[model samples]
Target: MAKLTDEEMMKMMESADNAVTGEGPATMAESNDGIAPLTVRKLMIIGCGDGGCNIATAIARKIPDETFVIAYNTSKRNVNEIVCDMKVYVTSDADEKIVDGSGKSRAYSKDAFKLNAYKNLLETVNIGLEKMPDISYIIVCTTTDGGTGSGSSPMVAKLLSDNIDVPVLLMGVYPSMDEDAIAQYNALEWQSEVERIGVPYFVLDNNQHGMEKPKVHAAVNNQGAMIASLLAGREFGNSSISIIDNRNLYMLLVQMGGRLVAAIDDARPSSGQTLDDYVMAMLQKNYQPEPSNVKGIGVFIKGSRELLDKMDTSIPEVQKKYGNAVLRFAHIENSDSVEIAVLLTGCSEAAPRLLEMKNRYDDIVHAQKEAASVIGDVMSGMKNLLGDPRSSKRRGEAKEPDISALDL
Candidate 1:
């Protein structure tokens, strides 16, 4: 066989550069013009916990039909609730015994997914993915506050990064400050492991937009969907305008790999809200430090076709404000209300909120330890108060029937 010429080589490579296209059996096919436009990278998303499953399923519901979405967890209940393209359940631990859920204990969660259980998850995920030949990227979604997702997601991501020759990104949902200390500390632990692995990631602070469970979950889901659109919405969004096609998303995610990228949506902007207001709010709420370190920004705006024409001017305002950042836009017309999503890449990873959470976690642990010294055990409180008949008490009381055992 004769070797191809430089022209042929260049043409083949220039067809789709870098980590944009998925390398599957159908990754390449012939078309009349030449090679088919495999330039549009395919995205494969896996949601790892209840919060993760909900967000992934919610995104699948809105984006263009046929977008690959999978929800996985140890809980049958969570797996049952998810309605998506695929559902994967870990079932039970390595020994093949069925288990219900992690019950909020990350340690127990990690253990429960051991041996056979772990292999089952890996095999199941691969089996589902094997059918899709053109998988360009893999996104792992999970909640940092819970037991199942929190314990298993980092391990899953790290393992997948090792096993599969694909770039893996993580979307972590951090619990609200008002949540229990278990959740708060769990969130921090998840952060530490994710960072150690060095996969680029972004987080959504629960209760940042609302306090109620449904409201918080909805806000998180919507925000995640907006980011998904940024990466893959070109299929759904009208392509005539500044559409964020596969190449654009490839640039935002893969080419600029290993940076904190956030695409937050602020919907139904009031008539009074300016572009600056929306951008600033999106940045702050998403835990981005400031726009200074942000190397790239992709904006998606949707509105009435007539009104969107006027909003075109708002697109350029981002560069004017951030200076030096690369800017792009994806415009979708015919929405009932105006909504804007701003995607930022290369922002500072040391978000102030993370530090605040760390300090809060430390304070909480310290406070609990301090309280432990003075706070009597609830079960033994009455027994201590009543004094023991067989033993001497700290208060110099005679040993009575130590009602503590009796008290309990």
Candidate 2:
């Protein structure tokens, strides 16, 4: 046996897709009729800015064929090579020259959206909605540290909230500790604005999972894709207990209305592995704070028949940890490993890093103000105090450190 190459794997997947669609006769278990053939619920994603668009592309690959992932970006260079269901350019016709990027300035992206990109963006979104009217959920993803994502995502989310009846979620990618002050400041500011918009949102911190840039990027995108796959529900298998539909996703992410922390764990079939263990694992893996005023929580566990039969559906361990919160649990069939996903909302106020950023921003402002007040005329004040450079007093004698002992 030999391992398949990327191209080989892709061709196999394409052939399987063709088989499912009647390009050839369908023989797969999933292709068989009768069992409702997986969760039919669909979820749409709109990714804004560089980071968001990249994640969207990754998500598009992971989701089912009918589901669409749309990317919105200002730079042609940013999204040209990216592969997604649709790409909408955020443009400004008024500008004499075409700007390829937001230049790390959120204001630029926001102004462009408000000025010229508004109509096009809204129209394109409506068109997508019309094409996929069955979409139950809409997730708007963006990189909070970048100019375009930080500036444009809030307005985009708000626009969707105002016009569409569907539940919309904003997924903002947070900057890592190693990122520069500008990126940190942009991320911090964007977080504040998104929260104020009153849209239920989640921030995917870039600092965790990996240290290197590419690793961190992949980790965040992969985590987001997993959330999408779980929320949309699988396209095959019957539930041993209750099936988690898009409505559950809505109850936790949208109706809850605050920051979200979602995690998924693989529970291999074993005597020791319990549903409680799976939920606890997810809790441990969550990037956000532990659920404190959790308005709502949705837990979905999928596994084979044997696994589901053996599993204890009770979530006492979770309730004991999170206090009183709306907890919804569902266990469906997956045919593969026992998979579990938990979504917790209403932890926005407990983010410590955002508080640290606010303090840091205030300190910077205060220091600048203090420095400005004192330095009415810096060089002139120094000259007046020292008299003239020609005077002996103006030139102070150097006092060197006695390093003769250290030199030895």
Candidate 3:
């Protein structure tokens, strides 16, 4: 398909915005039922790489129709393959083509984003916001190992945060340890950039899930989508004693130090099972180091009113375990079963893999420096023996070997 010019793209987006706001000739469809139309706050999911696109596609499938989904990449193949509401390719100038089949060159990817990709992204997001004035959240999804995703996502997040009014949530996928050194290095670099950006983010460790290489991507994508859906306060239609609306979700996510991790347990209550037991189990099973120094905690309970009341009382005890972390509660009523979902923010334990990756990257750099020094010494010795102008060797000294006489 022919690429749309910038002017054409802008016109198309403006037209869509007009249609959405009842200012254009096009009209919105009527609701099927006699019930009033439900007004939902819109969410924009922007995926930055192959892994990110996978997660965004999964999320688009699960989120409400009002949610906007777009995927961005420098690779034409990846852009063509991903399923999203929009696909954006960050093409380079004719003189500078940036293509790495392995997706390992982060420097090139960063250049691509800075040169023109970010502008395109910002423009597209502005158009989306115009169409859906209720869009209060922007979720930026990317993997912290590949070239385009890792190199550009942090900058994109920062750009969105600085230019847009909404809260930008970063969903970073951590690469497995067994991946190549370049990926590890890229992950470390990307983490540093994200830390500098100082936005709220959640880390999904691909290695911890115990899935095989071939299946892990899909698993990661599905899990991320599920968490995002829940956080967006979408109703599951089960009985609810209390509701956590989208505004409440926005408040929880917009807190300072937005490093977050979550866990969910859905099981019938046993004789010995307690709310404390569920909370402890989630902390131990889902997160590393138990996430100390938390600033906010969100607990969503699905059970009977009695069970919900018990959990509500247990919140104080849970807060005590985390240096008096502030708490938010959501309850749903369901008989014969209990479900717990935990979202912990401002946790240092959120991105332990980033620390490991940084250490690994340092070691790799040290090794490379040592190797380069040895090569430099060897080259100096060769130059000395060859009698360079600075070496001052006598004519009688042995000369360097000449292989020109050897037969092919």
Query: Residue 286: error of model 3 in Å?
Result: 3.1
Task: Please state the error at residue 305 of candidate 2 in Å.
Answer: 4.8
Residue 353 miss distance in model 3 (angstroms): 3.2
Question: Please, what are the lDDT tens digits per residue for candidate 2 over residues 261-322?
Answer: 77776747456766666777666666544565664556555667677676655456665676
**TM-score (all chains, Cα) for each model:** 0.70, 0.74, 0.73
* Number of the top-ranking candidate, with lDDT as the measure: 2
Ranking by lDDT: 2, 3, 1
Cα RMSD (angstroms) for every candidate in the order listed = 8.9, 13.8, 11.9
Give me the runs in candidate 2 sitting further than 4 Å from their true place: 1-38, 95-97, 267-274, 287-290, 304-306, 334-336, 359-408
* Worst lDDT 10-window in candidate 3: 19-28
> lDDT per model, in order?
0.64, 0.68, 0.68
Q: Across residues 198-313, which tens digit of lDDT does each residue of candidate 3 receive?
A: 88888876665566876777766876786777666553333323433443355456643557777676765566666767677776665233566675556667667567555542
Clash count list over all predictions? 11, 2, 0
What CA RMSD would candidate 1 show?
8.9
Residue-wise lDDT of candidate 1 within 281-325, one digit each (tens)? 666666333444555555667677765655543344655655434
Deviation of model 2 at 185, angstroms? 2.4
Which candidate leads in TM-score? 2
Ten contiguous residues with the weakest lDDT in model 2: 19-28
